[model samples]
Target: MRIGELGNETGVDIETIRHYEKIGLLSVPPREPNGYRNYETSHLERLAFIRHCRALDMPLADVKRLLDFITHPEVDCGEINRLIDAHLHNIRERLHSMQSLEKQLEVLRARCGDSHIVRDCGILSELVAASHKTGVKKD
Candidate 1:
């Protein structure tokens, strides 16, 4: 089939499919005699795999690494496990940071209870004071 057909089968955009080819994430298919790019079932499968990895929020570099591993099944999987563990650690760190941010926002929200104009808002006052302490004058 053609690029569009392959894209439809894999649910990937044309540009994304092209981008994957350009970025070495997907192999470029051979062209037909009429010069149309010819894609096969293997292309569909690889595109789906790429899309799944992207949906998992895997970085492109990691996706490439994973693809390399997929292509070389004989390789040991210990490194793959290590990579996943590292990614999990990074995710945990981000979660912790987000929780801290939520706590900070909760404190800021609590500073302004139900009633106050912008000028009298405790949250704004605290922000202004904190900004001044940090040498950032808020207008």
Candidate 2:
């Protein structure tokens, strides 16, 4: 099938498919006599695998490594396990950072409530003081 048909069948954007091809994630398929690219069943399966990996938030480099493993099924899965564990560690770090950000925002929000004019807005005052490096501690 043509590139458009392959994209439609795989639910991937044409540009992304082309990018994958350009980046060596997907192989370029043979073209017809009319010069139209003819994708095969293998392309469909590979694209589906890539889409699934992307849905899992796996980076392209990791996806490529996984693809390498797929190409060599005889390799032990220990490295794959290590890669997933590292990804989990990174996710945990981000979650901790996000939680800390939430707490900071909550503290900032508590600086002011309704019924105050802009001049007396405690939140804005705190922000301005912080921007100037006034060393004003949060209460």
Candidate 3:
């Protein structure tokens, strides 16, 4: 099939397919007699796998490593398990940080009970007072 047809079937953009080829994620296909690039089922399957990895938010390097593993099915899957575990750890850390941020914002939100003039706003006053105490000018 042609590039456009491959892209349509895979639900990936043509430019992204080209980029994958450029980045060595996807192999370049041979051109037909009419000079159109001819893609095969292997390309479609590989592209689908790539798209699934991307949907999982896996990094490109990790995806490449996973693809390499796929190419060599004899390799032990322990490394793949380790990679996924590491990614989960990172995600948990981020979630904890986000929760902390949410708590901090809740505290800040509680500083203001009602709307007032900008100068009389409790949140603004607290921020200004904190900055003054810290010897930092408010931006």
Better of 1 and 2 by lDDT: 2
> Which tens-of-lDDT digit does each residue in 47-106 have in candidate 2?
999999998889999999999999999989999999999889988999999999999888
Instruction: List clashing residue pairs in candidate 3.
Output: none
- Model 1 per-residue lDDT tens digits across residues 41-83: 8898999999998888889999999999998999999999998
lDDT of 1 at 101: 96
Model 2 regions lying over 4 Å from their true place: 134-139
Separate clash counts for every candidate: 0, 0, 0
**lDDT of predicted model 1:** 0.92
lDDT for every model?
0.92, 0.94, 0.93
Q: Give the worst 10-residue stretch by lDDT in candidate 1.
A: 130-139
Task: Please state the error at residue 126 of candidate 3 in Å.
Answer: 4.9
TM-score between candidate 1 and the true structure: 0.85
How does model 2 score by TM-score?
Answer: 0.86
* Model 1 RMSD, rounded to 1 decimal: 2.8
Question: Per-residue lDDT tens digits of candidate 3, residues 1-139?
Answer: 9999999999999999999999999999999999999999999999999999999888889999999999999989999999999989988998999999999788888988888888777788888877789895677
**Model 1 residue pairs with clashes:** none
Poorest 10 consecutive residues by lDDT, candidate 3: 129-138
Error of 3 at 13 (Å): 2.6
